[model samples]
Target: MAKKPEPQLPLGSSSTLRGLTESFSFHSSPESFITSRILAFHKEHPDIVDTRAVVRAKVLNRNVAIVSSHAQIQQVLANDAAGYEAGGAYDELMAPFFPSPNLLLTDGGKHEAMRRTWEERMGSLKENVIPLVHQQTTEHFSEPSTSEIDLYDSMKTLSWKILLGTFLGLEHRDKLFETTEGLQENLLRGQFSLFPVTVNTGFWHSPRKKGKEAKRKLQAQTLAHFKEKESACPFATTDDGALEDIANHSVLFTSSLAVKALASILTALVLNLYLYSKEDGRSLAESLASESDPGRRSQRLRSILLETERLSPPIVGVMRRSTRENIIPSTGEQADVKIPKGWDCWLYFVGGGRDPAAFGSTWDAFDPERYINASIPQGAAFGSGPKACLGRELIREIALAMAETCIGLGIRMQGNIAARGVRGWLGWEPNDAVKPADWAQDMKQLPTQRPSEPVMVRVARS
Candidate 1:
């Protein structure tokens, strides 16, 4: 194939269509600034709704189309959710790794069916999931809590393990943990390839293909190991009989992103919970600490996580391309702006989740307790309608357990000292330790870690 285009461009020279086609372009652009900018933008960019300027808006291509608006985002995600699809977006970007078809990124009934089947298999562990989460917590906490660990990396591992338990049904986890750990790391690293151009050196492809073959091979090995274990899983569907549908897609890659995304989101949520428990957070932690019972504490934590998701998004939002013919709705006078059949549209979910109209007065606060009487409107935090995040339960369970472990170990983002690394993607890192908290003024807080909002307590063991 001809040489792929380079990844970088001088500021202001990039076009919206070209920006989306390339990976990591936003890093140097003003969008990078928006990713780090505060809730103030929510006030500044009313049309984009809590975002940067129109110049910033025009760069993140949704579909093949080169433009998007909050209104278009609403229609793509909430209005015609089932009608619009995520496959095209996934195909152009994620196809290299997943190779096989995936439901989480696909459209229609097929996506729904795949989601349902995975849910059925995962349901077997409904009760087991929480316990496993608790166990995972204990294991993480059992280690020296004083050491500054990358909570971001740590959460990724824990989430991946939980995913393994749910997907492969591994009973004797002690022996399986290490191998799976390596595999999970390798697999998650493949997302680095999402950069489109191979120039993002620090990010695997960074500025060029440095560890290209090595990264690909490691990713392959990780999936192969997963496939082997998956075959052994009693839950595995047979290729011969009625279970053939399982063979239709690359379950390993298809499922990995959800696990990775869930892991990232869960890690950020727990960080928020830990921070919130502090005197600084919205003060939800005190109630959490007050509750001596672990189950009740977990429930309180769950509400806190959901509220955090609402206030601050893990990824901001999903990108969509208008594939079929249709005019944008909710645009008011601009409804006829002519979004031709093939174009890209970015749904501004961060603003949508925090919209005062959608989330109410405390939308910008760290009030997990506020969630009790109040209700949050539907959003694209875990995606909007059709492609809504299917691992919702799993992400919640694992995150709660992570909080449980942190409560038990007293692990925290040392030093109100926090910093963000590698674009806003590092989330927020606590300087006292390797832990990262919320980087943005995310109505969401330190990685949703914004303290002063939450309150926390520990179980006094005899």
Candidate 2:
């Protein structure tokens, strides 16, 4: 028998296929443009909760309709999510940058199991590692602030050190300090992906993939180091005593991916360090600066990050797909939007972070003070609900540390930096498929913690 003809997709679906194109600009690709566009659109068209636009594409996919309502976004992240498989699409799009496979790539049992492992390691880190956070930050901040310095690069150095120390628990963890330093240098250039589909597709995009490979090699040695210690005794075996949870070998392997995830965390703190140092942010920073209190600093930093996340979310939005088919629970009169299967769900973290319905009047300004006073839940920064950012503790700790260090040491920005947002692609993940020379020139600041470009800053004792 002859094969039956397959049903055709809508012509508009094919020829009219346009991804969220605005997210990726050719000539001038500043995140501010993308953020303002989507946010402005949402602000004007209140009724249309989910506006269809060409934000960016993932591999073969395009024309993603970005949604800002928290509820709409949440529906996509739900494990019982019915309409689509966001992680799958994300994996397809970003796998080249993060091929090692970790918590963010998949959903269901395996995702949960790995996530639990990661959570345990992180939760267990609070006591043992938090003190180090204080110690290092305090020491770094103790010095007098004189010359200007790239605040984010400085923080990235600290964040990288802290993460390697706490998570990897490397012996003399600072040894590998520089290893994670410039991780974001060539990484953000991947932003051109949404537009430069040709180059990014071939061997041109391989730094992140190479990083993953390096991590895999390191994992073996790392695991050997840990196993020997475990065979001798458990890491939590000390007295008076802080509990030291050894990052599992499995985590060691998964770290190949985790470090890439960390680019967002690193980038966020770096952005905020300079942003909060600005005139607009100084008010909130001033409030915390005078306190000399960790709790107060935490509160202030939370506000700053929320505002930053609202205005310049590093990961602007998370891509999610429904795991189970079901109606989303809602408060309004109408029922939840019917989510069909296999749809790409884009959560407007940037949208909800700045939602007028959620934030009310002062939604537009860069007001960190709102987080301290307003009722808007500061949940979107690391996400909320069941799948909240598991790395939230680290995000908070690192951000707080960067802020406190600035306050105590009086670290000033030697030069101006933009706390701008991200467009087509996240800036942290590298395109491993591409050769280093093919990418932009690697700029240096710190011999170890160099960023993509030389973000010039001069520094001295405060």
Candidate 3:
């Protein structure tokens, strides 16, 4: 059988009508925009590496560019001074939660200082973090359950505990968990509200107002908690000002952003392993557990983790704005596209990871073997360049340890999995009762991308 040639769209073209439709689609049906609209566009016109669209709304009308190719994504992310600056979108969306400058908001020297400090602290704690993750995973599934459990919720709780213990030096029995979780929920609701801008008025009950209040309470709680355990913090500094900086930024890590992302990735990982095992007619868990060679086991585990992440990235894309007029340099087949100053560019990770040119013809397949001896390209997962995720390495270690523990305990999906959006699974089954309309209502893309519906599972000790 021969492959059909992909249709090519003219380079550097803008569509007014299509852009308006897309803008409306993004505002009304954001959850499906990527899976249905953007992915569908890529499939239809594979040769279009970059396209310009105007995002029009009541409050704002901005020129938006969507960059999907691996090469183009790498170039944009790597060159920060080429008129592109980070944190424009983040500053707008995450202002309520992270009011102060943190790792996500800072750039250049300030970012380097904070990232280096946190990296050193995390590296020192890596040895202890692995055992803690394993211990938490084991204890989570140790108790017997008469009914199926929500794997997503379980993972979220586990991640929350580990992060609190690791960053804030809080024990499992700490009373702040309940209070913090509530405040975190409130903040997320406010941040991701339907209308981008929220009016803070006393006339009506507003989620944004509630969210701001929650931020204040959570900030106070975090500061007080840190004051009591300041000496025990892994990243604690002798300087009071530096310590306060650490405490302020700690809110971002402990908030729903970090916790939900870790939990979502872990959930997707477990689901992928189970689905792949069934397809191969072999127990991936057994193979991983039976492997006696430590090096081989670790390598295989890392490959599997990478493959899972490539297919179902927790953060689908990152946003950046052009500070000055610039041109995205042509790379191979991709042509140079002009990005005017103030135009927002979205580097789509999902599209880049699944690019057949980069990952082979079977890019969409769940094949971990492809990564066994392969060099992963930049922007494939955690992203590339200076603004890439700092906690990616630590996240991988924690997820792998938790995954290993789950496999050792013989965990498996019990009931039909309900998902808000498709996660690149070829033949996995979803709950039949959920209508197509219901999925749109449940899908969420901000903060983290994961199934909003419960993913039921059963754990049996082997």
Candidate 4:
């Protein structure tokens, strides 16, 4: 029997397509954009045994590891929690957008302290949160008419309102919304301007300068709101008997990027439902409405949400920085790869979800029943290990409730749906609708996932 040819690592290739098809190329070349480059890289490099798949690369003049294997990615995340603190390229890149030392960029004691405050408030606030989610869902999403909808835009507006009014208890929700509406765009525009190669990294230049200015303005608004003491701030003042923890307030507020994250997930859910239902000769809204038992409906909805998360995660990958030279804990064949200190490790979390070894033969297909019945290894949906996203539960509650509400209201979604972006930043682009100028500008904020073409959907009441 003839042996299969060894796969080549993504190295120098003549054609951009050839580079992406043959090996793992991270940057956007003339032949392809960043989103296509990333997708091609992931699709081709599923297994880690091929050294070419998980090889090292230089990004922004720093040593970097492009990890695709589930075990290797998990090990990197564990290593980060242990010693590889968050400060490095990502910190420098995101500094203009995020405040100094927040949860996303902090490690050790400070992160733990802040996380505790967040968990305490978020966990106990369910009574407050669930009701607010329902209220917001009704207001923004429960309309009973045949109005065309842009799922991405509509969901963002809904999530932002919930975050400000319900989660943060801000009284000036409308004013804050108008002011910070451009927040995501400014951050994305700045990141893109600084690092034209990719949407994730950037330098301290005009784009970043503009993003920082916008961020500072939002932070000031938050500060003034706190000073007024009109409403309680969840993270600012906690009942945990710990310190008054005021320093990380801006970081906490800025973490509303959770809004974008949830919006992406919900968009995927809607698209999947619309496409799949059309295949079975029954509308998703009809099927959902037919289920009279709330418990069964909830379970099915959760399964669909999980499946969407597994098949199409909102964020493509989670990044971590190595604080010191160390041996990354290994799973299979690549245990000996030594990661040098100061190197950035990119965990393709979504790639892990699609790992054939982990999920069996049907890994690529969208099958919610896999989640409902099978015991699949819980891939990094929200994330894995210590630094996993803290707002997973909040996102789940809001997304599930919104899905259930929309279905119950007999809302049917129709349009051309395509996934666009690198990693979990993939946003839905409905091809049938024309792009609006305001919508296009708003999407500039999250170019990584939100496509240049507006995602216009026809939302009709059944």
Candidate 5:
């Protein structure tokens, strides 16, 4: 049997109509950003590369280019070294939470300085952060014993504790978590809100207002913590113009993005382990515990984490904008393309990670061995270039700890995977023989990329 040929984008058709309608608006409905749909679209129309590595369109009244080709996307990210600035329409959507001049907003010298500070501080606290991950994981499972639990909810709570306690150095969870939780919910809602501009206006004004109040409370608490630990924890720098300016930015990053990342990864880990258990007649924990070689065990666990990122990236996409009108040199697929000043660009990571050309024909399969000898393309997970995530190490460590602990506890699915949305945020079971038509239908059914139902799991002592 032969594999089906890749599909081509037809000229003057419904795709163009989708492009027209979608491009006209700067704001993306929560559904529009669903990872599966974008991946399906790119897979369905591989010719986007041949036509132009950059998919040109109008967005937020500006010429927007969605760069899907992995090579071309890397070119755009590295272009930042030449003259491309980081902020864009998506940045505007994030502005309400991250504010201007934060790590994501800054470029060049300022960006370098901030990143350096974070690296030094996080490095100093490695011993603290890793253990904290295990502690939170233990606490979450400690209560339920053998009863079924919602893994999604458990991961979120555990992630919040580690992020708040280990990263930000907050201890008084009673008063602070509520305020932070309020801000986190609003920030999430604002991120996926249909009319993001309305976040701070009229009835929607309440979220923004609540977020502001939360920020104020958080700032005071952070300032106090910094003062108390200033001498002991050199990382909590507040007086200097560098980290202090974006103090609130740190709160949102830890409370929202970090929490979201950890929860998403944990869900992926649980699902993978559950399916593996069913097939192998042993849980991941049992396999891991039986391994005698520490080095091999570490490698295997890390490989699982890497595969999780490849299959279900926590971030759906990475955004960038051109600072000046400049030409992006050609790749094999297309000619050099010019991006006007202020043009917004998106790098679709999910599509790039699953590209058959890049990852071989079984690119969609859940094979951790692919990464043992093979290398993932740059920015395949947390991103690449100057703007890559600074917390990669922290995220990896926490994920490892969570994986080890959950597997050790004999975590397995308790009921049918409870999920919502058309296809749910959690990925479907891997099927190497899935037909293209079935895959497309799955993508179309998804109202939003994120899960709508609780991810339930059970634990038994092995």
Candidate 6:
């Protein structure tokens, strides 16, 4: 019997291509641009997925190829011959925050060694991190706040506390935790500078300078704390250069980079569950809480989380720079596209997750049952291949613990919740019909997709 051939993606020039100014605007509001421009392109050219395809364009004054197809994206990420390198752009963008190269910015042997060291230092996640997360989450919801709470802010604070406790051996009430929290916030703020350069002159007031100073202080404090409590610290080690490595890795866990990513995911997940409860006329929390079988509850929880991630991925896209000129082979009949050396390749996770070919025709709909059998791809939310996120397991554990705790406590939303600029229940919904004035009014699109405006929801026991 003859098998059906896969559909070919268009190699033709993109009709929705953006120029320099438009590209700059796209970066400023990527979700909005994707909703308005990219999806529209897909609709107009339906043969691709019935519309899953790649679009090439100039982004941030760089020659960029945006890959959206699930299989093709996986191939690009896994293929060394594709010439895509993860470190160049990451190092440049994150230099202000991370004084030394952390795991995200290292590759090959250095990356492997660092990952192994961190894994060893982390010990058993089930034994160590899970218990800590459970404890923190339980304490957080033990006395549920009977007041309107900003969901994003609350989640951010909780994530920061958990990360600090897990890695630095600092309790939430510890003096060092209080002191380093402010420094970490300031350091994160520095990364948002209009110009990505740091001026070190004492006469000038620069965010990057302040950020650099904060990083120095934070690292020094972390090192001293580790030295003082070597026996107690989870990451403590006596190996040569271990202290420096731990301190350097601290920037990754404690900074906005890791903390914000987890927070955004939690915020999105809770919001989705709340919305689902509203639509279904039953509390998902109660449903999970009422289930007697542990396996069923776990499975249902996993499915719900997966669905939420597919709809609203925390990290929308990742940037990879080409190491050399090379051709990216197509999964279908389309000819390979020649990528120039040093060109930036943006892997669009949001788009890939929504690709109808992989996710079915009703890709936009939130359906947890689709994940029950584990037959579908989970998408690139945590990334793929060698460059996949190292903290993925920890993230899952934290998210599961937090979700269970919040629901088990009977926390219910008090009012209508909305992000400032973005629309739809999930906040990052793609709607091409929206006016330009309303797009990205108050949202951060890169690094993570989160609302800049407060997403306020009053909490009370149901």
- The model with the greatest TM-score is 6
Residue pairs clashing in model 3 are none
Q: Which stretches of candidate 1 lie over 4 Å from their true place?
A: 1-74, 169-191, 194-260, 277-286, 292-299, 331-338, 405-414, 417-462
Clashes of 2: 40
Clashes of each: 53, 40, 0, 6, 3, 1
Which whole-number lDDT from 0 to 100 does residue 26 have in model 3?
58
Error of 5 at 427 (Å): 7.1
Q: Write the per-residue lDDT of candidate 5 for residues 140-201, one digit (tens) a residue.
A: 66665557777667777777887777645654355765666666666655454445344455
RMSD of 6: 4.1
lDDT against the true structure, each candidate: 0.49, 0.47, 0.67, 0.59, 0.59, 0.71
Question: Tens digit of lDDT per residue, candidate 4, span 101-192?
Answer: 56777777878887886677668666677777777777775466466667678877776777766544644355655565566457656654
The runs of at least 3 residues in candidate 3 whose Cα sits more than 4 Å from the true structure, single-residue gaps closed, are 1-24, 27-60, 80-82, 196-198, 278-280, 330-334, 410-443
Tens digits of per-residue lDDT for model 2, 286-340 = 4566667678767777776656555544444566654433344333332244333
TM-score of each: 0.68, 0.65, 0.84, 0.77, 0.79, 0.86
Q: Give the Å shift of residue 217 in candidate 6.
A: 1.9
lDDT string for model 6 (104-187, tens) is: 777767877877877776656546777788788777666667677888898888888788888787888888888888888778
Write out the backbone clash pairs for model 4.
Answer: 10-24, 185-445, 314-424, 315-424, 316-423, 316-424
Instruction: Supply the TM-score for candidate 3.
Output: 0.84
Please say which candidate is ahead in lDDT: 2 or 3: 3
Indicate the residue-level lDDT of 348 in model 1: 53
Candidate 5, lDDT over the whole model: 0.59
